[model samples]
Target: MTKANLLYPRKERVRKKQASPNFKAAGKSIEQRPESINKRDNSGDFEIDTVIQTRAKNECLLTLTDRKSRYQIIRLIPDKSADSVNQALRTILQEYQINSITADNGTEFSRLSDVFDPEHIYYAHPYSS
Candidate 1:
């Protein structure tokens, strides 16, 4: 017998199937995003992500990107608490009159409605990946 079979002669490996279908395909496609996002001075739209320190459990950096001008802002914070995130967002929004933001599904952003008007802020669907 080959060495591969000798190691586990009676065992069989089964491929695992996904528990659910890819959900991102069900949402509004990126092609559907406004063409204005590519033009200069499109100030209201942004993409945001959080950068966490590998060595520090509580340290994080919030990164925001302006879709049009490709402008970026980063905020370092002691922790990922909602209060901290809200404060950081408020500071960024104050600097620029942000109209909308897109972010991945993260618990840190769950309190967005408390910080901004729901009508003004839009969230990408959680399952969209």
Candidate 2:
């Protein structure tokens, strides 16, 4: 004889709202940046991004690339918060000759103004560029 399993009531899963900060104050649009940066002939032009480990807890990687030289700098970060990212960029910028930085409009990159000149930092198109 097979024993019947008891049915239990399940609670609805609560969805967490994703963060999307208004980058207007801290980030600039790539469209408005000077045409010189797009050429990528200058050594100081760079691109920035982040990598997060879904399996790990509170660990992220901050990545920077010099558009002209194709050099890359990768560092482990504590989290994906804007403050953490800003501080990381500030420290890295100290060593690099950063003329401009082009980044995607992610929440973590919203406050890059802390490290870069407002006029030199720009965000790529949300869809594609």
Candidate 3:
């Protein structure tokens, strides 16, 4: 095998640790949503989700879309921390009136009820979406 004096590459393969999803929902369950919201009979009801930047792990986009109107609001957040998400939601609340919000079971949304009414924040089932 060494007849041609070929150099053997000595390199170690490092595996990155995968982060587990925080599947705990922060607020009320989606099943608790009122008929007005469930049927999309109102304009103030909205759905919230976060889009993480692929290249910048620390940066994310918070999106809110009105269920009835399909209008959307997108904001750039510095991180996925609950505090950052609350801050972004607070700012949005000042400009818009959101009657209710539906979010996934992400840890970053654990504090959503602090910014909005606890009774109005609904969470989807874990791992369903």
Every model's TM-score: 0.65, 0.75, 0.79
lDDT of 1 at 13: 81
Winner by lDDT between candidate 3 and candidate 1: 3
Q: Pick the lDDT winner.
A: 3
Clashes of each: 0, 0, 0
Model 3, runs deviating above 4 Å: 1-24
* lDDT by residue for model 1 (1-129), tens: 775768667666886544245544222334455556535356868777788999987899988888877789899977987788889988877877776666665677667767766544445655555
Off by over 4 Å in 1: 1-41, 127-129
Error of 2 at 116 (Å): 1.8
TM-score of 1: 0.65
Error of 2 at 62 (Å): 0.6
RMSD of 2: 7.0
lDDT by residue for model 3 over 19-127, one digit each (tens)? 3585445678999999999999989999999999999969999999999999999999999899999999999999998999999878888888888889899998876
Score residue 67 of candidate 1 by CA lDDT. Answer: 80
Steric clash pairs (candidate 3)? none
lDDT assessment of candidate 3: 0.88
Alpha-carbon lDDT, every model: 0.69, 0.80, 0.88
